[model samples]
Target chain A: DTAVSQTPKYLVTQMGNDKSIKCEQNLGHDTMYWYKQDSKKFLKIMFSYNNKELIINETVPNRFSPKSPDKAHLNLHINSLELGDSAVYFCASSQDRQSEQFFGPGTRLTVL
Target chain B: AQSVAQPEDQVNVAEGNPLTVKCTYSVSGNPYLFWYVQYPNRGLQFLLKYITGDNLVKGSYGFEAEFNKSQTSFHLKKPSALVSDSALYFCAVRARYNDYKLSFGAGTTVTVRA
Candidate 1:
């Protein structure tokens, strides 16, 4: 069974549209994170949540927001998507602050 | 600021031969080190981690890493390579303290030829 899973492996839409990526973890983790992998293969953290409470918010744009209804789910919603927003988004979960994170298959977002 | 470095852009090895992907880290105080692998069209998979334990740590899929305190390095190594093991590897590091977000390396591509 997949420990962490994300919905819609691939997303395609036009610029100025709104999109959301859903994530779920069955590993009973208290912390969840969102990472963006650019075309150059560099991964950067955008946000992190612990037990449905937002923790880390790097200098992400205001268009990007994350909501965790419960500990097991953290979803990312991006409004007014632009061409620069196109990238692979990954969701990860960890048992706690210092544990190794389990990642879900990435969602490739494409904006035209 | 904590950071990780994967010096090699790519590492090539033949099947049945040993392989190594180098990784170095910089962090204040104690550090939590991690190694992850990623295949094409997939997310990064947890390989192993070093958190206040022995210098050498082992993880899934026949992989292990050595954490050298003096050198500030955590390198992943395997005794034998397989073609199926070819993928992108990333090294990450975090401070031992709380709310220590992980910092990842640029990544190294490993190509194992059969």
Candidate 2:
């Protein structure tokens, strides 16, 4: 069974376009996170939500927003996409604050 | 802030040989360390973690890691590696008091030749 899943395994768009990536976790996790992996394979956390509430927001641009309608779902929306946003976006979830996170098949976003 | 470092960018090994991936971390308070492996075009799979206990932690696929508190390092090791073990490996750290934020290292690419 897929514990975490994300839609649109690949995404390509022009700069200034708006896009959204959907994520869902069936692991009954209480915390969810958004991470970006650059071409160099450097991973960084962008946002995190706990029980559908915002918790961690890193040094991301204001154009990015995360919405959690429920505990099991966390969606990332990027407005006015930039070329620098081209990277693999991964969604992860954990049972609590101090547990190993399960990752979803990442969405490779390409902003042309 | 909690952070992890994977000094090596790539590791090459032959089948049936031993494999090791080095990792070091820094945290303000106690740290929670983890190892994850990712195949091409796939998500990261949890291999193991060091929260507390016996310093040496064994994980999936005959993999193991030794947590050194004094050195602040957690290295992944496999006694006998197969070509199928080739993948991207990542080390992550999270401070005990910090929220759900996990700091990941620049992944190390492992290539096991058969």
Candidate 3:
């Protein structure tokens, strides 16, 4: 079974489209995070939520929003997708802030 | 600002040879360091971490790291290398307190040849 899982592993859409990536963790973690990995393989943190509360918001665009229905689930929704948004997005979780992070298989989004 | 530096973009080694991937960090307070490995087309897997109490920390897949406070380094080391050990390795650092967000390096790619 997948410890940390994300849906729609491969997403292809047109510009100006809206899409959402859903993530869930079965490891009983209280902290969750979103990271974006570009084609260059540069991974950067986007946002973080602890127990469904937003704790960290990096220099991400406003078009991107993170919602945590509960601790196990943290979903990312992007509005007005652009070609620049084409990249693999990863979902990760940890038991605490400084603990080791468990990452899910990334969702590769392609905007045409 | 917290930052991690993996100075080498890529490291090459032969099978059965010793390998080392260097990492250094900077933070306001004492740092918590970690290393993760990513194979092709897969998400990163946690390799090891150094929170406290140990200068040399060991983790999965026969990998270990030495935390050097004086040098601000946490270098990943393996006694003998295998072809499968070749992967993209990331070094991350964060504050010691809770709710700490990690700052990761650019990553070092290891290539093992026969």
Candidate 4:
């Protein structure tokens, strides 16, 4: 079974368009995170949610918003997507704040 | 603030040879170190972690890491590397007091040739 899964493996949209990526985890984890990997392969955490509660909000732009409808799911919505948004976004989940994370197959987002 | 650094951008090794990827970290308090590997078009996979206990931690796929508090380093090693082991490796560090944020290094690409 896939512990962590992400939908829309590839997203190609025009500039200024809006897009959303869905993520779900069956690991029964309490914490979920969204990370962005740039072209240079630098990974950075953008947002983190614990038990559906926002815990860590990094210095990300307001255009990007993360929503957790339930503890098992976390989704990312980007408004006014720009060329800079072209990168792979990863969704990860952990049992708790101090546990090892399981990551899902990343969604490759391309903003043309 | 906690951070990790992977000085080597790439490491090439022959199949059945030993492999090593260097990593160093900086954090205020005790660090929770982790190693993750990523294949092309795939997400990062957890290899091992060091929370507290033995300095030498063994992980999945014949991989292990040594945690050195004095040097603030957690380097990943594999005794016999396979061609399939060629991928990108990341070293992450999280402070004990910090909530749930992991600071990842720039990443090192390992190329294991048969």
Question: Who wins the lDDT comparison?
Answer: 4
lDDT of 2 by residue, A1-112 (tens): 7899998899999999999999999999999999999998888999999988889999999999999999999999999999999999999999987689999999999999
Question: Which residue pairs clash in candidate 3?
Answer: none
**Candidate 4, CAPRI quality class derived from DockQ:** high
TM-score, each model? 0.97, 0.98, 0.98, 0.98
What's the CA error at residue B49 for candidate 3, in Å?
A: 0.3
| TM-score: model 4 vs. ground truth | 0.98
Clashing residue pairs in candidate 2, if any? none
Q: lDDT score, residue B106, model 3?
A: 96
**Candidate 2 wrongly placed segments (more than 4 Å):** none
lDDT agreement of model 1 with the native: 0.94
What would the per-residue lDDT of candidate 4 be over residues B26-84, giving only the tens digit for each residue? Answer: 99989999999999999999999999999999999999999999999899999999999
Q: Stretches of candidate 1 above 4 Å error?
A: none
lDDT of 4 by residue, A30-99 (tens): 9999999999989999999999999999999999999999999999999999999999999999998678
Error of 3 at A36 (Å): 0.4
Across A1-112, the per-residue lDDT of candidate 1 in tens digits comes to 8999998899999999999999999999999999999998999999999888888999999999999999999999999999999999999999988788999999999999
Q: Rank the candidates by DockQ, best first.
A: 4, 2, 1, 3
What is the lDDT for B51 in model 4? 94
What is the DockQ for all candidates, taken in turn?
Answer: 0.83, 0.91, 0.77, 0.93
| Worst-scoring 10-residue span by lDDT in model 3 chain A | A92-101
RMSD of each: 1.0, 0.8, 0.9, 0.7
Sorting all predicted structures by lDDT, with the top scorer first, yields 4, 2, 3, 1
Full-model lDDT, candidate 2:
0.95
